[model samples]
Target: MVHLPNTPTREREIKLSFLSIMDIWSWICELPNLDDWSESPVFELVSSGQADQDGSTQSVHLRADRTSGSESEAAVIFTVCLQGFPPLNAEKPLWVSEKCHVSRENPFLPLIVQLVQEIIALSPNAPNSTCPRAQLQKLKPEPIAWVMDSHSLESFSTFFNLVFILRLFWLCACDAPNEAGSLYFQSLLPSALEIVSSSPLPVLRTFLVTVGIDTELCFMRTLGYVVAKLCIFRELGVGLQVLVPPPCRSPGFSYSTEAHGVWALKGYASMMTMMKVASSDGLKPQIPRLDAKESVLKYALAHQQLEALVQLEYSVAFNDGFIQVLARIDNIRLHVAKLGFKNQNDEAEYGEEKHFPSRVRIWVGPEVGATYVGGLSLSRSTGNAEKEVEIQKIVKGHFQNLKLSKGKAVARTSTKTKMKNWRMDQEAEGNGAIFDAVLYDNATGQEVATGRPYGETSDDPIHGLRRRYVGANRPFTKTGSVVLAGDEYGEEVGWKLSKEMEGSVLKWRIGGEFWVSYWPNQAKTSFFETRYVEWCDEVDLPLIPGKMIV
Candidate 1:
């Protein structure tokens, strides 16, 4: 429970209130004939007659309309005690209701009845105990009906302000569940859309601010979900126009950040989904024609100047908005490459340079067997090519030169040949090995140092070492060992291999020192073999190759 200095205790209270309010709004929105209820007036006041003989008291009747029908109405009769006047000031009367009774046949009478029943059901049974009426008075009907009937901008503005404050409080609260807030927003989406569509631009702007659209604390998931749902509706074009008003239509239109831009892209994605759904259902979808220059996706890719091109690429790749667009584009990788993306492997295929190191050192462990010798190599294309260079090698060895036990025969010649080239392509044909050493610095604890071959492009040097020495297909044993691979200088780099102890079952263990041997391009012989070598605890080298030691 880390608490910030600025966070107040009322934050949780405000968040719960917002969720309750939204839930209430959702229930009201889902009610049948809401538009009719909003227009038809739920309550009507009628005066019956004078209450007393002196006409000092009066009787007032209040009728509430139910959804059942206009003819069936609930009526509440109240006897008002007026102060010494026959004809009292009805509008601003100082009269108090003395007695009240509601009609039993009223269908609208049980709005609070269900809630009261629920409370009573939850209460514990006590012997001859009277339930307090004051406790029950705390429960009241939510003012959703009032909000729906509010036509004045001022009322809406005040309501928006309250919601805004509640949302702000929730945003600053550390314990608030973001998903809960998102769910509430999703539930109230229909009502929110209705409000946004009906409100004027100024009012809409205020409402947007209340929802944290232009604020630093904007809720992206909720906003995206609402906009996505709206995009699926028939008023797709109009909804987008309202949310993202074009600069030409309104010169003052602006967004605080690219958050809205990302959401707009999501909306576009949802629109595509809607179109697909419509097409599948044998219905025509009214697709809106958006200006390319004003488009969020186009702006993000073309001129947004994002700090990380990979981020934009990922957003487009994963975002629903760009799915159809990506499918339509023949060469999305090339398109992204032209947008100055260089970190991804797909972009590397389109790079100008094909120069790779030629002289390579191969390392192998005792698991490679005792019959063959092999090493790793590098190759590159001479001219412009579209293929990226390859790295990794695996070798299996075969044994030869056997002597019979019965006869005294001379030992036969042993030979080995290269089994597989990890990189078997024409692009790396002209590859020349660069004299770079792969060193692991124990002092700084760096896994792969800058001096390693292809260090700039390779992020995981330990993986490379594993592939080179452990014979790609071999399973790792529990014991630890060092395998070295080097250039022509014999200044080999070593990787320490060890099994993870926690939750690991050690099925096999290999002991003693050994070396990996291989014969390249040989006929009628094995390509790889693991031969016995003198065991040493550590190599007398200045730098290691891997971060972990066995």
Candidate 2:
């Protein structure tokens, strides 16, 4: 435990009261591990009005014990007696009551009920024994109902445990196994949602990101379990406009850092699953889903964005408001994921670019061994469909320019070939090497043209010109005829030429989507690219923050 300095006037008072509480518990309990409970059940009983008739009496007695350590033990003993057995209630010990007086506003009773039920369900007949972890699966309804109704942020028991209690409450509210319990749980969902949304506790919010990369809560696993249970809140319009709060400005491992990643991924997955279920059951909601973007997808690729990904990756982040950055990154990722593929891969293919004039090479799936289907798709003109017509006009103009370039190249090639053939004829009587002739519209530059003469003789032929010429601009022509027929006198005119061109067709096969693909195109690898540039731009590179991933 980190020791904090005692500076304020009330600091000593706090220390004294805390020590007295410990002493009281030490004297009254002797069952299991004493260290396990930092507090006494006796204190709980008295504070709730089950023991003390008046709150002031308990405070005074606790106060007196601080001033008189061992020297006035008798006086301290007397005060305890006065508090525990006021003459009017001497028959009852200081901590006895027929009914619990825990305030309905206090979160303690409901949390206690949850903890107790968790213990009972796991431990069964063992009244005083701690429950085993395996049996404490999901939370029970009684406690969730109590907490939902109470909805107070006051930490009556372990301030740390309040998050867990609320989390369990939300989980039951969303996923109670039975209708009897679910109906009651559903009724409390709105209240629970309100409590979480309005509460400013960082722990409470991070409790929704089960990954616990956010360091606010002391115990990682406990906080994670709490966060993993927010499926119910998500279903209740927990979009950016309603659920995520403003950024937190505090330092240290806060919830906002890791939460954004977990929430976006889980929530998106859940939403998709629910959509599938609703489609099958005919119960879909009318709410429109936002498309996921590459930038947001980058965030969900959890391991990569952890510090910036969550926050620990930056040394400067330790200076201030790092939690806010974490929250921003998270919300952005969530928003993108919510948008679905529309936000990520929605760019329009324009003009001849859709046909991929240049041969393209793409890997299949995420692995190399996964074989790819490769073929070329050509652009073609449509007669009257408005959009396709406009696109074809643009493509035709571009193809005309390409034809000119191709024609010029062919003219140059033809001249070179004729000279070589003339030299060969003079040297060897033109019997051995015959020059095949063809024409292409290679004009002013490398671009092909509107039209060209093409042919292949049985002898020497260049690779690009020898095969069938599929118009780079209009490969799939509406006329459905071969573009350039070979002058070969084969039985099947240009069919063999077409067969030879098959290998070069550019194929566009679909790949499985990545979270990054849901955001901006370059977002996956570039979210933190500028940060790195800034870091390197500094005269000295900072020590890789708190902990480096590797």
Candidate 3:
């Protein structure tokens, strides 16, 4: 049977062993006092007897009791199971073989200190540096020569928590703008690059991948800012290997279905910010190369996350090249064809495939004519050759009778309907489809205002427009027009032109509405104003030129 040390004897021995590591103790004591940390329960060291013939085989367990908290709370924080005592003549007199188990919630103070020390070591001579070495050197001398010694379960969880804290601090420091606030960050970056490039802690890597798509916009914003700064400083390349380490870089990176959904939203947001910054700075946007594996589109579809797919569409709008990337995925065409248009509420709209309206509609109206001549439809097609042929036929049919003057088509859709005084309908009516229409200058192909169908309770037309036109890669010009079409005479469709005012205000007017009237701004953005006024005196509509097509 193994003998165990008495409580007082074990306590004395543990104290002696802990006190011998003067530098580590000093570092712990010097940690800045955080409010929550100060209030946390201190660790209580306990000694237990192991199943060994020698009484020397003892283990040390570190625990912290919950402060009147839930019973589910963890009581033990850490454990050090000593295998055996070192030989008396061993170079390291106190060295012992041991196994450590740390609580998932316990913060590994030693590892954190080591990371800070590594950073300080990298930049020992930085101006006004409060390096860890300098701080430790000022500590009181002890008899024992202190050496930094290198060393999970309930322990794995504790280690994960500790790693999380380390990553959070590092990320936060990198984001801090003030020099003093970023002192540690500035010192740590070089080493951070190496750590990330080399063997990053698995727990830390997992944390980043899993939470990379967190709902907290601030976290992503901050992470993106830091990433941009790193890129600007030439510390990181377009690969973004730091945020996505090699292990998690694989297409089959371990992520739950929920994680994929979160990534579909937050990951896209982060990537957009990164791409925008890179574009503005003239740096090559490092779009991740997922050619060998299933693309994000596949992940989104597998999870049945249509909203995520819609978000992807919005991302592609700002970056034209993304469309090409999307096109290369074989599954994309099949999936998109199978999945019809999603409405504002993300509900799928399924009907006759031919009647599945295009995501974008191009309307052409002559400056001199009362009626629109013809419209063009553009959408992702499963068959490119078939789509091209169909497009050519439609263009030929529409432009058959148009005469070009200064590269502009002077044409009308039809001459049968005569222009007349019309009033807007007071009650809002459904357009039957989301208005994802765009007006373009036929001569220059420059886009006008993108149309968004609005309901009576709808607000923020700009946002609505974004949702409708998910792949609009261009910014809205300063001045644009929104055209509305109605089914009835004197209650028809027309354009409302807007001019940019001082402080970015948009001044809108009913620029010769055939049947459409000015929509009121119910929310912050423009909405379709279907309501018309009482019919006024008749005005002569512009007649189609004799040579112009019907």
Better of 1 and 2 by TM-score: 2
lDDT of 3 by residue, 1-550 (tens): 0011111222222221222221222332333333234443332222223333444433222222223333343232222122233332111111111211133322343344333333222221211222233333322212101211111222223222232223433323433222212222222332333333333234433333432232112222223333324333333232222322321111111111112111111111111111111111122147733332212222111111001011111100112211110101001100111121122111222111100111121111223332222222223222222221111112223354667423343433422322211111221112111112223322233332222234323333232223221234322211111212322212213222221111121111111111111122222322222111110111111122222111
Evaluate candidate 2 by giving its C-alpha RMSD to the native, one decimal. 27.2
What is each predicted model's overall lDDT from 0 to 1? 0.24, 0.22, 0.23
Where in model 3 is the C-alpha error above 4 Å? 1-183, 193-218, 232-550
Model 2, 416: alpha-carbon shift in Å?
A: 28
Please give me the total number of clashing residue pairs in predicted model 3: 17
Each prediction's TM-score versus the true structure: 0.17, 0.22, 0.24
Model 3 scores a TM of: 0.24
Give the lDDT ranking, best first.
1, 3, 2
Q: What ranking emerges by TM-score with the best candidate at the front? A: 3, 2, 1
Cα RMSDs of all predictions? 29.1, 27.2, 26.9
Candidate 1 lDDT, 1-550, residue by residue in tens: 1122222112111112323333332332233442344432211111223334655332221222233323323232222122222344242222122111233332222332232223233332111223332233333323322332433534443344333323322222223233222222322333343333333334333333332321201222222222333333313232223222221111111121122111111100111111111111121146734434223221121210000000011011112221110101001000001112123232233222111111112111213231211222332233242444444444444345545323333434444432222121211111112222223322233322112222222222222323321444321111111211111122221122231222221111111211221111111111111111111111111112222122
Worst 10 residues of 2 by lDDT: 529-538
Question: lDDT, candidate 2, residue 290?
Answer: 47
Q: For model 3, give the RMSD to the true fold.
A: 26.9
